[model samples]
Target: MLCIEVLVEEPSAEAALKSLLPKLLGSRARHKIINFGSKSKLLKVLGQRLAAYAARINKGENLRIIVLVDRDQDDCQDLKNKLEVIAVQAGLTTKSNPDAQGQFMVVNRIVIEELESWFIGDIQALRRSFSSLPSISPTSSPFRNPDNGGSWEALHRFLKKHGIYKSSYPKIEAARKIASQMNINENRSPSFQCFKAGIEALLSQENENLN
Candidate 1:
């Protein structure tokens, strides 16, 4: 079986994935999440982490790494290129630059704006998580493209408007709740879809290896 090691920048992303990965991987794969406390910290030590993983892979361990970080005002392509460079420096093949056989040991995904964008993408999931919240049209402004700027603020405002999270948003709590109810297939966020695609690609590779 393939063991997936997912590295995320913060606790909320870890909380969200805890509920969502099971729905995606099922019995086909084993996975673990490693939270780096903050995006700055994660980026600071990412090279060393990937280098360690590369050493393990060289020792014949069957492992794949997935790095997830929020875009948060950064140039998206530039951030991606930075991650790709780190992986290459660590001697690991990334999804962006696969080997001759089209196999890679790492995938780097950026959550556009923030993780809450995914919650906004699936309005039904948000409603299911917080029943008191009113319905939001998928085509509504700002929310129509959940990947737009100020996504977390947008979500928090809507939640507060409905008397939920009246003070500050408890990110981990909201992520756990909303993500548990999220239908991966129904999410409209392009970045979320990209994340799903990365997982699917890894699973597909595992299946091909078994064959």
Candidate 2:
């Protein structure tokens, strides 16, 4: 079995992943989710942690690491390149450079705008979480690209306008609620699909090795 170490940006992301992974990985999956307080903290210590992980890998430990961070308003390619550079600097392999067999150690993904975009990706999940959430066409402007504004704030406004959550967005609570209802294999967010694809690749590689 492969051990997965997921490094996330915030408590809300951690909560969401905790709820989603079991469904994604099944009852027998082996993984650990670590929240790094904030994105700043994560970027600060990511290299050091990757170095430690690289050392463990050298000792024949079967491990895979995933770093998930919110893209916010940063340039996506630039962020990914920075992450890839850090991983390589720490002596770890990345998807950008693989061996002849195409093996890599770290998978990095950015949540477009914010993790709440994931909930927005699945309108049915939003409706399930908040009964009063209006059924807008998935093809509509708001639903088309949930990353339009501060994704979380956009979600807050949507819910507020629809007579659901009247106050502020409850980050952790909302994550747990909406994530539990998310269809593991059927989200429309490109970033979410990127995340799922990375995990699926790792799991597939692990299974192949087991055989």
Candidate 3:
């Protein structure tokens, strides 16, 4: 079984990803994420800290440990540090090009921090993407079981909860909400499938318009 380990700061984001990431990536298990309470990055954390965390996992060698980020609160430099810390701590072997003073195959994501402002740059969306769970409602459950319906539905629900879908009319998330409200989940939420799809669609549309 393929496995993915994720270190994130937003519970909702993790939940959103959990709903459809496995399906989208054809993963065997949902990506396991670690959302630290105080906003520590991969670099801020120590090797011992990472060892402690990674050791507490069920997934083995065929695992992809990815850290999803929003990068709202962290500076770019800060984000870089955090990613470095992740590899140093996870006990994942890294080959050092001692001459250049850098290690090879260090895992992390710095794109989120840069995309934070464009994505939402707010508390609700930030928390959702980073692994912070606000008060969940009775109508919506946060735990995602792909075996049930996959992430297509769960991510749609999350967008509504955080107001990401409603705020932008005719946007991907908004379109998804409309489709979901009408019970359409056969192929990627009728809009794109997941947030990632919506993003891709928008980018492609923009590129087409540019050309």
Q: Give me the candidate number with maximum lDDT.
A: 1
**What is the descending lDDT order?**
1, 2, 3
Q: Which residue pairs show collisions in model 1?
A: none
Which residue runs of candidate 1 sit more than 4 Å off their true CA positions? none
How close is every model to the real structure, measured as TM-score?
Answer: 0.98, 0.95, 0.42
CA displacement after TM-score superposition, residue 153 of candidate 2 (Å)? 1.3
lDDT of 3 at 68: 46
Worst 10 residues of 3 by lDDT: 182-191
Whole-model lDDT per candidate: 0.94, 0.88, 0.40
**Clash count for each candidate, listed in order shown:** 0, 0, 21
- Across 1-211, the per-residue lDDT of candidate 3 in tens digits comes to 4344556554444444444454454432445656553245433554565565456432434443554454554574676565555565566532221114332222445333222222221223324443534654333343222213323344446656666444432333432223222211332111223334423332333345346
lDDT of 1 by residue, 1-211 (tens): 7899999999999999999999988897899999999999999999999999999999999899999999999999999999999999999999999999999999999999899999989988988998887768878865789998798898898888889999999999999999999999999999999999999999999889889
The order of the candidates by TM-score, greatest first, is: 1, 2, 3
Better of 2 and 3 by lDDT: 2
lDDT for predicted candidate 3 compared with the true structure = 0.40
lDDT of 2 by residue, 1-211 (tens): 6789999989999999988988878854589999999999999999999999999999999998999999988898999999999999999888776667888999989999799888889889888888866677888856888666578888888888887678878899999999999997778888888889888988887778788
